[model samples]
Target: MRDLLKISARYGLIGSALIIIMFLVFYFSDENPLQELQMFDLFIIPIFVFFGVKEFRDRYNGELLKYWEGMTTGTIIALLIAGITALFLYLFVGWIDTSLLPEHIEILLGNLEETRDKIVEEMGADSYIESYEKVKGTTLRDIVIDSFAKKIIIGFLITSVVAVVLKRKELKPKS
Candidate 1:
């Protein structure tokens, strides 16, 4: 477990660093937030999860990996990345850019009508209104929760698939 954790943490740091750099660059450059986070969740993190698990199997696990082992390692990596990300987010919001939280919240509030319009078609007018009200009142805490939760969830989901794909059966010695 210790070795796995060390490997996972190293990979998690690489992934998180990539994400932080990309996020800061795009944010400071005024690129679209929607595109930036989405791309990171979809593309960047999974790539590292793949590498992390592959390395664990090849370098540490005798070139064999169980699905659960891969999944657990990847999940640990994700959890580490999420914790780091949350800390960074708190620092960025609390110290680096005091306006980040408010700006994101404001953007969300601004999209309320658009979101309602889309949800109303699928769920119903009542649901949309309820959701709109809930979203309209979203606080900084809510954003922080969502920011970390989304990545953690995405990481788990990605790892689930990646682990399966990378899992290798251990070869037994010949009698």
Candidate 2:
């Protein structure tokens, strides 16, 4: 557990820093931070999850990693990464630049319009519009929840796959 915490903390910091750097890249560029393509940047979390578990096996566990050990390490990495992301989100929206969020929400609404049109056409005007309005009204708190919730959920799935791949049982000698 001690090794897991130490390894996860370091990897989690790297994952979180990458997210913030990605945000800054978008925030500075002409591109909208809320752009759908930015979802690709989320690949960092899984990468770190794999690294954390792998390091635990290689550096501390004597080249033997049980399925549960890898899974737990991955989970710890996810939790730490998600928490750091949420904290940075609060800072980004609440302090670093509050105005960026309103603009981001506007972009979110603009992008949603085309999808909303299709949804309305398929389902009904009123139902889609109502949901669209709700989405457009999203607050910074909502963004915080959304950003962390998305990472945590996806992180768990990635951790599961990584754990399965990385798990290696110890070989025992016949007595």
Candidate 3:
């Protein structure tokens, strides 16, 4: 268990570094921030899964029990990584550029509302707009945390089965 925790911590650290690099790239680039964020999200899923499987393989000798262990391991790593990133962001962006968050959050909410309205309008469910309006109380930071939680949960659940299947080891009979 100590070995597993050490390996998991390594995975978390490496993943956090990669995320910081990506964010730095986004900061320097002139491209649309939303597009850059989407791109980051697209690549991060596979990265997380890869580290998850790697950690399981390293610690358990390619064997897992019932697959759920892999998922649980993956989720743990994801949460740790997300927590670190959130802390960094809060310290740097929240504290350093306090005004930036509110401005960007308002823009994001407007974009969300517009997209939601369009979807409801097309689907002929105008009633949902009232519910969507209720979203005004939420902030971008809240959304980020919620998204991280959901992604970690679902990603771990799905990847756990894949890891177990890919890395399971068979027990040998005693002589």
* C-alpha lDDT (0 to 100) for residue 25 of candidate 1: 85
On a 0 to 100 scale, what is the lDDT of residue 23 in model 2?
73
State the displacement of the C-alpha of residue 80, model 3, in Å, after optimal TM-score superposition: 1.3
Worst 10 residues of 1 by lDDT: 31-40
Candidate 2 displacement at residue 16 in angstroms: 0.8
RMSD of 2: 1.9
lDDT of all the models against the reference?
0.79, 0.80, 0.61
Q: What is the C-alpha RMSD of each candidate to the true structure, in Å?
A: 2.5, 1.9, 3.7
TM-score of candidate 3 against the unseen true structure:
0.70
Clash counts per candidate, in order, are: 0, 0, 0
Q: On a 0 to 100 scale, what is the lDDT of residue 53 in model 3?
A: 63
Task: Tell me the tens digit of each residue's lDDT in model 3 across 62-128.
Answer: 4454455565566666766767766766665656645545555567567767787576776656555
* Residue 150's lDDT in candidate 1: 85
Which segments of candidate 1 are over 4 A away from where they belong? 32-35, 115-125, 173-175
Best by lDDT: 2
lDDT of 1 by residue, 1-175 (tens): 6778888999999888887887788887986443357567677678778889999989988888899889988998888778787777767767776776667666766777767777888899999778767867766566667778988988999999989998889678999
